[model samples]
Target: MGNNNGRKGPGRREILKSAGAVTATAALMSAVRASFPGGAFAQAAGPETDKVTLGFIALTDAAPLIIAKEKKIFDKYGITGANVAKQASWGTTRDNIVLGSASGGIDGAHILTPLPYLMSLGTVTAENKPTPMYILARLNYQCQGISVSNEFKGLDAKADASPLKEAFAKKKAAGKEVKCAMTFPGGTHDVWIRYWLAAAGIDPDKDVSTIVVPPAQMVANMKVGNMDAFCVGEPWNDQLVHQNIGYTACTTGEVWKDHPEKTLGMRADWVDKNPKAAMAVLMAVMEAQQWCEKMENKAEMANIIGKRQWFNVPPADIIDRIKGDIDYGDGRTVKGSDLLMKFWNGGVSYPYQSHELWFLTENQRWGKLPMDLDTKAIIGKVNREDLWRSAAKNIGAAEADVPKTTSRGKETFFDGKVFDPADPKAYLASLQIKKVA
Candidate 1:
């Protein structure tokens, strides 16, 4: 990881500047201590490791981490210095989390929701060393999309794949295969695309090919005729539409409203060793998330993240989607939608156990995890809701903001499929397209 300026290392001046900043932050925290009651201020402590590095990909949802670093929110929370490093891909993010700080990689990252579980289970690890990871918080929700190339321009396939099945068949018969791409196998994007295809009786595995492509490269791959369609997070999806390479089939929110997407993932060892530091990071990011979810702050957020050091795309490409101004690039436009990326509001930041259960169940459905695995036990071990609650309490979060229970009950998908966390096995059996065995 590089310095905050994206340079190889910090200079002596940078170190001195960081120390002065921390001294100023301490003064500010002291001044605000008299406001909160019940010694809430006593519980908040400086991070064990004030200087730390975090990883992020080139996606809009990575805003909270970037904002926390850019706006000095981390410094205010006793994280004297923080570096937000750019990861090449989600796989690299996973690998870096596994390697951890000891190997000069990341301590944590903005990662896919299911990745922590998979990493904990050693399903997609480098050396099968099942790294114990914890979900600090969910970063954002419902800003991903499934996109198809211009070849499917005239297809009447909005939320239904029946019309596109024939094209896939024809292409196959003609000795050319239709392919779909997702950021990672068994990730949120893959699951969404799989669910969409399966809902219309088209098998993702049998009907067409599914391949892995990094989010940033998705539009380029589609442009070069490498894939027929792709499911990815913005601004790539929006970038594709802008570049006339592809059109939106449907937003992931249309598939599953307010779907959990990226998460703040950290190694369990790091959390245990630096419990106060972990809370500091969480508190700063929580504040940053609230700032990001505000409508007034979105444009500035877009400009900050769209810089060459961050997402490296035009601000306009990133701004429209954050404001819920959507263009499907096929003559369809949505003026505004409540289904845009939500960073803080609507309990979007809560690490719901039910959500993780759904992810585990999907992993099982796709043969990524065994169906007989103890989901409740695994979830309890992986999801640190206790830590989240503690952070919330220390930060003086609103009473309603803290959930009464970890379970969000049940969720209903766009295809009318219901997932009851209590009866995950039954839900698995009911799924028409799955490989539970």
Candidate 2:
């Protein structure tokens, strides 16, 4: 995230809300229609609730939610009272998600893909009390970056993380703590960095102390030498490279291409109580996703989300990376790489149950979840792909937009390890590094 150029303090945070759709005009509606010819959903029964409060972090993937609110897509879908608020950190997001809007928090949020499952099972919640949540949609995939301090710029780690193993070992040998940072403990950033380190034979759990830093604070903290390396979504990594504090070693997409990242998550009670309203939210976000996928809209999207009330960032830090232009900052720059973040990609938005299984398996591998846990049962309850399809149908989504099956098939990693969702045990057994058997 970009530095808050005079946009600091709590007052600006209070203004980080969606402009109500009440002021939407015919011109904007016509523009929205031009963006997606097939995206307009037929008028039906109005949403039960006109308003729904949601939360988002200062990350690029949160654009769908922001765009939905900013472009008045929520209003078009009959949710006139939609608001997307900025959250301080993933911890704050978790706390607010646990404390529903009725309790002065939020009803739903742009969350880490594994968070819904983690929150649902009480593993990541306080007092071990379950806060059931549903994964409504996969927000976006790939383009998140693993950035390293400029101290290792000469090493030119890039996609192969082997050089860092020796550097971290030497740092530890000097009796210094080798800290590797991520935004949240079982979130997408955590998984990406862990997988990258482990592929190079570095044990993320023992080789280095993994620390938690908020996405927005990554650049600031790194500038002060708070951490050696960090894994986070866009703008922060881009800012780090531009600030000369670090260079991006590689994007997480290099570890696993088109890998699932964040999700559109909501409280189960809220969805159950207001199913139609939830559908309205889904349709609006889905349409925004379509708007985000186009190449022409990227610049405008970056400018919109970079406003003071949203990410408080410059459009320069976001536009290039979002468009697949990566300046590694270590003398390597790739333009038009296939690793750009995908929003409404073909068959990409589906909330695949198999994707949830991979995260659950990884958490178990790292001892975050127990081996005996019934992950299948949890997935069945948390993954709402059925609702995704229903909303897609209601929105008149194209045939290419929806997947026939929930599984995206076997996924292969950079280490040549394959995770077959059908047989998670086989995949787990193949892993040489883990805290669990």
Question: How many clashes in each structure?
Answer: 0, 1
Local accuracy by lDDT, each model: 0.86, 0.87
Colliding residue pairs in candidate 2: 1-236
Tens-digit per-residue lDDT, 266-318, candidate 1: 99999888766777788888889989999999899999999999999999899
lDDT of predicted model 1: 0.86
Name the lDDT of candidate 2: 0.87
Off by over 4 Å in 2: 1-45
Give every collision pair in model 1: none
